[model samples]
Target chain A: MKLSKEEIAHLAKLARLDLPEEKLEKITKDFGSILEYVGRIQKVDIQGIEPFTMPAKSEGWRPDEAFEVDEATRELILANFPERAGDLLAAPGVFETPKK
Target chain B: MKPLNEITIAEARKLLDEGVATSKELTQACLTQIQSLDGALHAFLEVYADDALAAADQSDQRRTDGNVLSKLDGIPVAIKDNMLLQGKACTAGSKILQGHIAAYNSTAVRKLMEAGAVILGRTNMDEFAMGSSTEHSAYGPTKHPRDPERVPGGSSGGSAVAVAANMCLGALGSDTGGSIRQPASMCGIFGLKPTYGRVSRYGLMAMASSLDQIGPMTKCVEDAAIILDTIQGQDPSDQTTSDTEPFRISKLESRSSNDLKGLKIGLPKQAWQAGGIESRVLENTKAALAELEKAGAEMVEIDLPYADEALAVYYILMPCEVSANLARFDGMRYGLRKQGLPLFETYAQSRAEGFGDEVMRRILLGTFALSSGYIDAYYVCAKKVQALIRQAYERAFNEVDLIVTPTCPATAFRLGEKLNDPLAMYLEDVFTVSVNVAGVPAISMPCQEDGGMPVGLQLIGKWFDEATVLSAAKVLESELAKQ
Candidate 1:
């Protein structure tokens, strides 16, 4: 249940959250209490019980058919992008540019 | 005629059918009430006044043409901001999606629209439905109509308040954990969390996907039944939706007429007492059980031994899902996008700025729980405990047709009281979470008043068996009304 600041930062990294240095102290303290609460799971009797996501069917498999989105709707979704070109969204480059 | 805003959906239908009242009059009355009271209540994030009036007028036109959609036709309703209304802002009460508009109608909202229910507006909620109190809303907290100093328990606080204060006759609310039921309890109205997969989640913003359900918050059990009838069914948009026969309000009434004879309601020995429930709340719950017994229902003492651990299981499993579901808010396509030269920085910075404190805390908790080193101890263990809890309920249902418990351990608490401590706030849902965890339908209805504040009695039924739950609640509701 003891969550050190280092662990909090590591979690922030994994979560893709830009946590500042100051937020770490409070978050770590929170993690301690929250972890303490859920720590009861460790004591739960699970000798033969399976790890279940839901009591009923949690998800369903849909056919991989091409569902259609009209042009107007597609335009609206593209419009929400931070960097937009004509009918397209610009995602930041995943690979570095080659040096000439 | 009675004040337009005071009429229930059934009453409005009767009056409108008799040409005694117009949908415009009812819709206008609600708008006037909102104009007058919403400044103090903060229940609505945005009100669709003009659009609602137009819809109401259209309903009037259709009715004049001798055509009607359903009982909900021409009635004004509110929607939790989390449920999408296409072209309306679906904030989920967070800055993360400050200007994000819903591209298409959520299945529930679309159903309501098709039913000719004039959606008044989007009500406030906890940011991404994270907190127990509406105080976590980035927009602002929704005040209790009964006591301005107290919170209208949330994240469906606005919808509850909307119905309580007559801003809308009924509203749709989504429950993940106890969001809908607890708020309904606080507001002294009827709220139902249908069995998971009973209602489609096509457009309702995801909280904990496995545990979440869209349901109705209304002034009466019958209205809850009517709304549920309209919105519950299979949909191609959501695969989890079942072909369970849609719940029938008439069947519920007919069942209630059987007068509760031989009906068994159970009280779990291991639920709702561990943290010392308030004396008044416990007394009200016991009194309600006795009242049901007086009306010919058999009340039995039962045990959901694993329910004592439901909270721990919920906190673990829910956040793990949250960590995964909320990971989509990375400033890439929609919602709050911040710029850093690289894509990674944009995601982190956007989320860091967009999410509120409670949301961040949960995301962190979820991330930590799902982390490789901690997964077995936290997430996996919680899931096993969840299965155990479900099994306990299954066994209990085999013995009893329904279960009864306090909707909340206490009435509505003051707004700022538990904000400082996260765990204290999470405990507000102790009584209601297990029902969601079990994937069963449960409802909260006002059983009594404690010092002028409402105490809610929760009726839980077998998975997908909302009829028994509503019927049993109707028996208790009429009993309370008679008194």
Candidate 2:
């Protein structure tokens, strides 16, 4: 499929990538061929073939259990967050407080 | 003093145990090698001279106290930057993650440290482990240790080069498609991507989480086994990890003779005619098969009719996973955050400035694949093909114990030879992708060289049958050593 700049831009938007204008043509061309290369799978007769959704049988693992966190590493984790107040992380605000 | 860096992990362990050497000395030897060659090879993203020495001294003290954790204790080991080493910079070779530090230890690094292994430093990799060559690294491409003009097969190229050039005794690398094996082959060493669930993926920067595995790249196969033995086990941190015992090397190395009297090896006929495989590679691969046959192994021609679709399936699935996995890098939390008027603009600006071109390409491709209209057509089709490919391997394994192929279709090409040709680069993983897709184990060991450049022969084995696979690789390695 010949992907137009608009389609490529739409994908970039969905993927949260801000592609530069100059690089748009090349990515458009690349996605075209990469899709073409992967498109070969459409020809393989996959009748009754189940999609391999998991890498391994999940039955072998232990049941969901909470484990103790390494305290020192927890300190490091809090430190790496760009904006944190006390133990809370800071990001763009989602909703404004309603007038009471 | 014999060069400490040149010794294999097994040999180093012996010396350290006998009080013949100290980890500090070995660490110094590796540091010296990096000091001399790293400018040219670009193998290490960082060299932990001080930290390694400190760890080595601790290892020496432990040995003095009659406590050696495992065979790798006190040995210098390098790691691919993709694996989180607490307090170390792990960019995954991407600009977007430049300032990101690993807050916790990846299970492999954690285990390696528990065994008293001194981490030399984090090595380079392809950005997000996407590209075939190390050129995709945000820093720069790593040159092949043998030939500076050529690429060291990548995204584990830095780790493989470190081992090949004696910069480190061994290195930990993650293989999604062929990252570990291809580079190991190009660097002329032994590398293993154990059965998919053999090692824990917790803290490993996931490329294709279902396929990614951490394994060892070593100077010899024994060292690979030793390292894997120390690192492989169930980790509650990673639920996908298999509840398997640690892989032991002694049984594999205990073979009294380099013989394969009753071993059945399969040669996938489709691989013999794979497009883009160089004539030189075919010759080397055929010659190695003859050597295996000479050692009493029976060569059986096998048909993997779906083998040709492996690359397509891998490209589709891996990128789809990459798209999802990389979504966490949004500017909110860490590394290269750019503030814009609105949140959407901030994400766009930060990601634009942070990711390299190839990474962007994959994320976009993945986005396209997993998007609304194309999901079934691309992603679903690919997964079904993956299933078919797995079934094909299962059928082949029923007849043969092992399958053999060239690690890559060609030896390390010139640095820029296929960089622009994305499809050409993707073809590099043709011989190795099916193993990951099928979730089986495979290894690449050094074979004959083509025009003095190294060639690697790959050994594919059934799931969780690493012992048999290593035994077969050992016999074949002995055959190559004979030459």
lDDT of 2 by residue, A1-100 (tens): 6789999988888887777777888988877777787888999888888887774546665766766778887777777776778988777654433222
C-alpha DockQ for predicted model 1: 0.56
What TM-score would each prediction reach against the true structure?
0.97, 0.96
User: What is the Cα root-mean-square deviation between model 1 and the actual structure?
Assistant: 2.1
Instruction: Say which candidate scores most in TM-score.
Output: 1
lDDT of each: 0.88, 0.88
Off by over 4 Å in 1: A53-61, A95-100, B256-258, B272-275, B449-451
- DockQ numbers for every candidate? 0.56, 0.47
Candidate 2, superposed: residue stretches over 4 Å from native: A55-71, A85-87, A94-100, B449-451
| Tens digit of per-residue lDDT, candidate 1, span A2-100 | 989998998998898888888988888877887887797788779988887533443547567987888877766776677787777777676643232
lDDT of 2 at B342: 64
Best model per DockQ: 1
Q: Candidate 1 chain B — worst ten consecutive residues by lDDT sum?
A: B338-347
